[model samples]
Structures are given as C-alpha cells and as structure tokens.
Target: MTLYHFGNCVALVYVPYYLAYKHSGLSEYGAFWKCVQAGMIYMFTQLIKMMVLATFFPDNVEEFGSYLIGDFFKYTVDIADLVGLHFVLDGIPGKGHSKVLTAGIGWATAEVILSRALLLWVGARGAEFDWIYIQKCLESNILLVQHIATATLIWLRSRHNLNNNLKTVVTILLVLSCYKSLLFESLIHILKLGTWLGLVVKGAFTLAYGLFSLSIYAGMAELMGIY
Candidate 1:
C-alpha cells in the first residue's frame, strides 16, 4: 500500500514536468510548483473528505441513510473543488475556447463514480474486493477506453483548428492518465510476483506497459503539434 501511494505521487508529479518540458519549456522549478499546487488541492479535498467521513460515518459499513448521505457529500465536495480549480486557474471561455476541458473533467468524474459504484455493488454481494487483481487487469482496460475517448476529442478539436494550448492540455491529460494506469498495473504485478521468474515476468510487463504509454503520449503530442 505504501508503494502504491508513493508510485501514484511520483507519477502525478512527473506528469506536469513532462508536459511543461515538452510544450512550454518551463523550468523544473515552475513545473514542480504547479505540481505542488495541484497536489495541495488534491490532498486538501481528500483530507476534508476523510474528516467528514470519519465524523459522520465512523465505519466502513454502509447503512442506508448514512451511505446515501456520505456518497452525496463526497461527490458534491469533490465536484465543487474540481470546478472551482478549473474556473480559477483556467477560466471560462469568452467565445473561442475548447470545451474539451469541461468535458474531460466531467468524463473523469463520471468514470470515478461509476467505478466506485461498481465496486460497491460487487462488495454488497459479500465478496472482498481484490484491489490488486482489479488494478492489474481491469484498470488498464478502463484507461484505454479513456485514452480513446480523449484522442477522439483531440481529433475533433483539431478538425476545428482550436487553440494549440487547449490541445496540448488534453494531450498532457491523456499522458498523465495513461501513466497512472501503467503505474497501478506495475504495482499490482509487483505485489503478485512470487519467485525470481515471476519477478522477471512482472518487470517485463511493467517495462512494456511503460514504453507503450510513452509511445501513446508521444503520438498524442505530435498530433497536437507540441513537438
């Protein structure tokens, strides 16, 4: 679990660095600060959520009224935080802005809610949810779907010749999403490896996945005319 958390943090930090380097030539300090800002936002929102969850729910077990309230509170707070960040940092369009940013946030939120609901439904069957197993196999599939959706959106945006910065932002998001998927897959596979041979196989899988993600990102960047 510690490894998983550390890997996620590393990937999140690296993503903005990569984007800044490839597109804007921002210094490491600039990229790092941006990542820090985003990290703070994420952590603050999650901390508030944890406090509320602890105070109100106190237990993982779900009662009808409590469960609904918890879910509603969690969803509302998360959405509000995300939208507030988006508006404050990115700003609403006057007349010529790609709606892709809004769409991306909406899609990501929907995906998270759907995934959690699916897990909850499965858990209600009295079966334990195997996070490692699900991350190994299912998470990649979900990420691939997201990438395809994002790529299609980028293509549509290009057809209209929207701002290059908008397309760059979308490509960066796609890369980050793919990187996260690969990182989760790596962590899960590493946890599952049993012997030297299994370790070798897991390492190979991680490398392949990483390379594939990089290729996807490079392609997306090229398509967005970032490089």
Candidate 2:
C-alpha cells in the first residue's frame, strides 16, 4: 500500500481509540509506570532469549540447517517469552486489560528503541527512510499492540478463562502461541533467503498479524462491554 493509504488506515483506527480514551478516562490505569515495568521485563527476557538463541540456535541461518532447526529454536524462544510475560504480569494490581496494554506498549517500545538504535549504529539513517522508515515505525506500533493483544489473551485466561474452563484456556494459548511462532519463523525465512518473495511474505504476514491483533482487541472490548 502507499504511504498515504496506510496513513488513512491508521487515522481511521485512531479516531475511535481517541474517543474511547477520552470517554473512559483511560489515564487512570497508570500506563506510563506500568509500561516502564513491562519494558524492563521485556529487556530482561529479550536478553535471555538472545542468549539462549545464540547458544543453541546459532548461525543456522548461514548454513542450510535453517528450516527445521531454526523453527525449533523459535518455538523455544516464543515459549520463553510467554513464561516471562506470565511471570512478571500475572495477577498484578491493575485491571487485566489495561495492564496488558501498558505491558505491551512497554515491550513494543523497547523493541523499537533497540531496533532503531542498531540501525543508527550502522548509519541506516543515511538511507532513504523518509517513506520506508515511517512505514516501519507504523508497522512497529502495530506489532507492539499485537504484543498487547497476546498478553491480553494470556491475562484474560489467567483472570477468567481457566477459572471458568480449562479447555478454553488451553485452546486460546495454543492458538496464540502458534500465531506468535509463525511470525518469528517467517522472519527467519526472510532473513535467511533475502529474496523478494521472502520480503513480500514477511510484510504480508506482518499486516495480517496486525489486523488479527486489532480484531482481538475489538472483540475483547465488546465482549466486556467496555465500549
């Protein structure tokens, strides 16, 4: 899509979100401090994830050992992330949904910060980012919110699901875990292949994932009669 088209899409989504924010007085959730705490958890878990990946999943991208091997490791890291998020945020003080959103923002913020920092280190700013970089920024925000959506599922399970039905919680976490694992696995394929098809697939999957995340958020909001 063109930059203008994407901007319109973002605006369309933003308007209602802004309206809800105003009506709910959403700031009472203390998103900022909670985000800081969530960011810290993300950073810590990210470091551990990297260490584990490097130690076990190392450089399979260079060799042809990438497909099965990389996927296995990707699943490992995804599970680790789930464990970390559960460890830090489960049964905490705030409302389940609000806290999950802040935690997601915090996690997404760390990701964007570290990613752009690496780009700057490589002088990527010298490249044509006027349009591409803006798109990346927007894409990253979608992803960050996706993180929140995943956390929300997990949080809702912890708060209400298992207490209601074990089978339902298992199904939800499993589906979301596969969703998370697929994204990471696709990313590896993109990096290893470095082909146009790979790039296109990666971008396509990212957008699809973003829409899925937003849909879940909207579903949850409606389900709870929050809006």
Highest lDDT scorer: 2
- Estimate, for each residue in 1-227, the C-alpha lDDT of model 1 and write its tens digit: 54454344334423433442445333322333443343354445556766766776546536636654544444444443344344323432311112332333333333344444454334423334343433433343333334234533444334445457656665565444434434444555668754444434544554554455445445655766654
lDDT per prediction? 0.43, 0.57
Task: Estimate the TM-score of every prediction.
Answer: 0.32, 0.63
Residue 226 lDDT in candidate 1: 55
Instruction: Please give the lDDT score at residue 199 for candidate 2.
Output: 42
Runs of candidate 2 exceeding 4 Å displacement? 1-26, 61-66, 120-124, 127-132, 160-227
Q: Write the per-residue lDDT of candidate 2 for residues 96-203, one digit (tens) a residue.
A: 556666665556666666765454334333433344444444555555545665666666556442334543754465465645546655676667754444445555
Q: What is the Cα root-mean-square deviation between model 1 and the actual structure? A: 13.0
Which RMSD values do the candidates have, in order? Answer: 13.0, 6.5
Model 2 Cα displacement at 159 (Å)?
A: 3.4
- What C-alpha lDDT, on a 0 to 100 scale, does residue 88 get in candidate 2? 57
